[model samples]
Target: MLFISAITFGADYDSIGDSTIVRKRSDLTQKLYDTLLSIKGNGIFFGMQHATGYGVGWQNNNDSCDIEKVTGDYPAFAGWGASVTDCNIAQGEGFEDARYKIKLFHDMGGFNTMEWHADNPFGGNCYWERRHDKTKDVVASILPGGEKHQEFLTQLDNIASFFNSLIDDDGKKIPIIFRPWHEHTGAWFWWGKGNCSKEDYISLWQFTVNYLSDEKGVDNLLYAYSPAKNDSREEYLYGYPGDEYIDVLGQDNYYDLRQDATNMPRFVKMLETLVSIANEKNKPAALTETGAFTIDAKATMPEDNWFTEKLLKLIMYNDKTRQISYAMVWRNGSTSHFHVPYPGHPAVPDFIDFYNHPYTIFMSDMEKYRTKNE
Candidate 1:
């Protein structure tokens, strides 16, 4: 009952009333969804954002430092950003390029999660440049009857088209955890706290889900809402849209590499809050994004086993927090913005141990678990 039987089409989702049709939401997606709902408090999956799509050694090339490329086993989930989906491109890397990556990642036996960095439709302003004074006005414009509503609709059309294009060799649309307007609690993006009112933000989120799922008939998506950092329950769900619109509740945090002591305790307490919320709502929770950025690769990389020593221990140490379905690290754009270490990097040994640990579930492990569950 947690999932529904779905059919996918290579052409368009809404125009699939005739002719041969492939299951758009494959049985594999159902298995993954069912497994996520059932694995609470028992185990957790390891994931990486843009792992194979790009990395330190390679940028959209054959030599990326992806989980499988480095360790020969893919991660449980692969994260991607939908920045360029607005400019008629699927994402930053380009339409065809991103399509190839998504297809390959899903075919390699990994789940997909995508986030968006939507440009300001009102003034055509970018995410980095903000005008808090115009935040409310911008929010109003995106509403159903707002002046800029048509532009917003155009953006969603392109995004829905791209998501529908993520087909496997069998021509099945890959299921995705579509996380739009993420990190809204942070004040960096146009849709952040200061940019829009809580009510308006919630409206935007609900509208997005409705337009995509109902209007466009994009049925292969599970909506996820992720906020940046918050200490208490109220702070975390300050602008929460509602339980109906959200399938997964997630959070993103970054461990400071400069500090000698790790923030595992704080993270544990926060996880406790997340677990409580998820249990109450009867939905899965995930550490959607976490990492140590701007590492001084030359300075011996402090606390080499940060993956096993800190991140993993956070979930293992607490009983309730272990309910998290997955924990994903950020991308390794370059030497400076890297999260996971490479083959020759100092943290490889520790990461290998983390990957081998029984509690950790990589892509292969997920397949094995799915088989057992089935």
Candidate 2:
């Protein structure tokens, strides 16, 4: 219910695109989209997954973030995992922890995005558990008439309850970018390409959106569809639900972007195609999840300035790719599996340069840009 007068839109319509499904979005959700649209081509907001929830040597500390320690400014965007709420076995904290962190980040003038690595509905350990029984299609089993349809609904009910709990001090719902079933192009999760048929994937996406928006009445959200690296745009859109059910166009590329300098062109071209699709659809695009898996001195790489020389160069490679609204790195879980630079890591100097770059927007930069645009 927190409406920004400067970015007001018709209450009954979506201003970003011709998506009727987004017509009933909350005021703050619409305003957030408008803000993203306003600053799309100007600068790319830097983001870190699980920024405030935990870090290299700390966990559950409200006042700690690896990015903040290194750059003196929080990321413009914060990525969170909703898998804990859905599966209770994935990479995020509990519901109350997520609610508190999300509200705190929003109150500090930062954007929030969440992804759900939902557990396999048909009996599995976690989202990564693939079934050996090729006779049954997991996605098919969870569709409208499938055997596990009700179980899927129960999981969605948990998700809706968690999203509904994201309230601010004024008791208004805090809008968030909900990204479920992400990285589907990869074959790691149950919803991956090889595990589910294209029709089933699309159906699952549409069903989730309809259930959350229409049945569950969860309207304070902007849905994002992100797939892992793809060979072509056709491959990327192979399982796309539709324009009406999607608000953001995002792609996750860690293999191409984090590799040597030779692969930088491929990453840039991939982003160009993604941005073109977003432009054609009139929606904001983002590098939803990326980053080197481990950025230590012993890690393999071309140069020491991974943040500036590699990541930043690829992002600034072409005008099309540069139009990305934001680029979010993966989480900083521990010393070996972290993404952002810690206090005395060798990547700190280049990270500072990356943070100081004109095209990179942090929290303070976003606030200033929004104020000026308003």
Candidate 3:
């Protein structure tokens, strides 16, 4: 499979990379970047995680989504997870389902992003498993010359195989934003700040990118570096793998915007810094993951209009922050643990208002941004 360069698209591809990373990027991948760059400064695209797979009061139903159920349209961006793609047979079934959903969304002119909550490689239960008194340095162990190095390569191979399998009806590859090791600034995951040294973390990120792009020949991807929320820009770029390896700068913030809407100024400050850094580096930025856990099993929302008054206000606060490419809420797991409002929910009217606002883009408004190949 010989991939062609994106010279015909008239994109400033050099700005995206100065190495082989951009050279091997597919034409659709470059077009996606151009599309996102054109969208910046105009409007922010709304997105949802695991949007079509399941939703509140539904599971694996065909052609249905919670956002569409409420807003009469689907989100412009759809997020998926690849945590169990390389796991056992029972777990790998989820990856197969994701492949179908990804292709379906792509065919509808919706953009896609993927994250990995990869299980801990060193005998731990899940990705959240931390290295304590009885565990090894997981990040170090998966690097170039450690004991679990071969196992890590096998995992990457599985992911690469999955990436290669995403094809359109015309048999062209579908481009997606691959975000791995997200929210690493927190101490909850195995790859968090305290669990791994800064050098080891950097090595792990660069190695993963190199392995997928160079060794495995996976070209239909745009890499994104997303860290947890940070007070200063320095904290956000703690273990950044350099501009050559990253195409987007993202931040996963749930505390300031969701926990207490009154603390919105902190989120605004972080957004300002994020957009500024993205501008300086010539890359797109996004609010990777965020949503008020209002309709949870144990708690209900204090305010009825959290979407318009809280989430939308945080993004539309200033011109710079509004330039963010997209803002995605979490998934709609069930009636109790959903992020977006479902049918008959009190937040429906306010969410509709947010959808009707010119600054917010959904799938219905994405026709103008379609690529030539698409």
lDDT of 2: 0.78
Q: What's the ranking of the predictions by lDDT, best on top? A: 3, 2, 1
**Residue runs of model 3 more than 4 Å from their true location after superposition:** 1-23, 85-95, 125-133, 294-302, 371-374
Which lDDT tens digits does candidate 3 get at residues 212-308?
Answer: 9879889999888889988898898999877767788898987776544566788899889999998987889888888874323222344568788
- By TM-score, the best candidate is 3
Q: Which stretches of candidate 1 lie above 4 Å from their native place?
A: 1-29, 62-64, 85-93, 122-136, 255-258, 261-263, 294-301, 372-374
lDDT of each: 0.73, 0.78, 0.79
**Residue pairs with clashing backbones, model 3:** none
Q: Write the per-residue lDDT of candidate 2 for residues 1-374, one digit (tens) a residue.
A: 43332211222223544432333677667777887777777898889888886788888686689899988889987888766443251332377777777887788877799888776665563354555565768889889999988888887887888787777786778889989888898888888888888889999998898888778878788889999988789988988887777889999987775544356677888899999999988889999988873323223333458888778988888788889998998877777677878888888888899999999989877667555534
Residue lDDT tens for model 1, 1-374? 23453323233334446643332334556666677778887788888888675676676463254566667887877787777532234322366777766776677666778888776765454463655345446766888999878878887888888876777787667788888888888887777887778999989987887788768878678788889878889989978886656778998877433236455577888888998998887779999988754344322235678878778877787789899998898777666567777767788888888889888888787666656555
- Flag regions of model 2 displaced more than 4 Å: 1-23, 85-93, 126-134, 294-303, 369-374
Give the root-mean-square deviation of each candidate in angstroms.
Answer: 6.6, 4.5, 4.1
Error of 2 at 329 (Å): 0.4
Q: Candidate 3 overall Cα lDDT vs. reference?
A: 0.79
Error of 2 at 193 (Å): 1.0
Task: Kindly give the stretch of ten consecutive residues in candidate 1 with the minimal lDDT sum.
Answer: 5-14
